[model samples]
Target: MNNVKSLNKWANAHTYLPVDVLRMALGVFLFMKGVYFVSNIQYLVDLISPIEKIGGGMFLLHYIAPAHLVGGILIFFGLLTRWAIIAQLPILICAIIINFMGFMHHQNLLLALLSLGVCVFFLIYGSGKNSADYFFKMEQ
Candidate 1:
């Protein structure tokens, strides 16, 4: 059918520059967050100490900081963009969960939501045409 053909065409279409820009913005934000966590590791450890008391919570906290740093760097350069987004997804979801649990400050809720949105967007659309992933012709 014509509709099906049109849909296929749309699906295969290259994304515009805005998508890349948004991806870069998210990458920078996540990178900075990682840097902040690393620089203030003691503070992060202290803040999460209570949650770490729960089973498996300490394991999650231990890996999240480094994951953020590595994922952010990969995303910023558009290298392995989809995989980077996938790697970051769990952290973003955990942030949403924490926020909903009233563990986050009211002002931080909006930031968490926004970051989640960006992560979801990149997860779905990928790095677009401007990324190293695309340049290297890696399949999305």
Candidate 2:
């Protein structure tokens, strides 16, 4: 009985609620963004503009959207947290560079950039406490 109690205490000693909140928030945001992109097909089409400049086109956009759609759901669930963050980084970076960098003059770009910035921060730091990464690292 004493050994069981000690093991339980050791397992939970490092658990933190704030980390879990952060992770959940990040996941929710990513999922929402994915849904928004899916609903706004034109927006995703515009996303391909950068690639278009390099000779790519709608084919790439179609492929990328499905990935984002799935990735968003993965992020929301805290499943494969690190990989989800990594997958979203490119899209976020492109948004920051293209929209936030003054490519367009309006509120839309600003909002997109702000959202992208949050995602970037989460990606760099992580989803927080209640995440696979956190517990996995604990085991290590």
TM-score of each: 0.80, 0.63
Give the TM-score comparing model 2 with the true structure, all chains together: 0.63
Q: Tell me the spans in candidate 1 whose CA falls farther than 4 Å from its real position.
A: 1-12, 138-140
| Model 1: colliding residue pairs | none
lDDT string for model 1 (7-53, tens) is 43453386787777888888888888888888988866754554565
RMSD of each: 4.4, 7.4
What lDDT would each prediction earn against the true structure?
A: 0.74, 0.63
Residue pairs whose backbone atoms clash in candidate 2:
19-129, 23-127
Q: Residue by residue across 49-133, what tens digits does model 2's lDDT show?
A: 6557766566666655665677766665656655776777777666656664445645656755765666665554544556565
Instruction: Score residue 58 of candidate 1 by CA lDDT.
Output: 62
Off by over 4 Å in 2: 1-15, 100-102, 105-129, 132-140
Residue 99 displacement (Å), model 1: 2.4
User: Distance (Å) between predicted and true CA of 72, model 2?
Assistant: 2.1
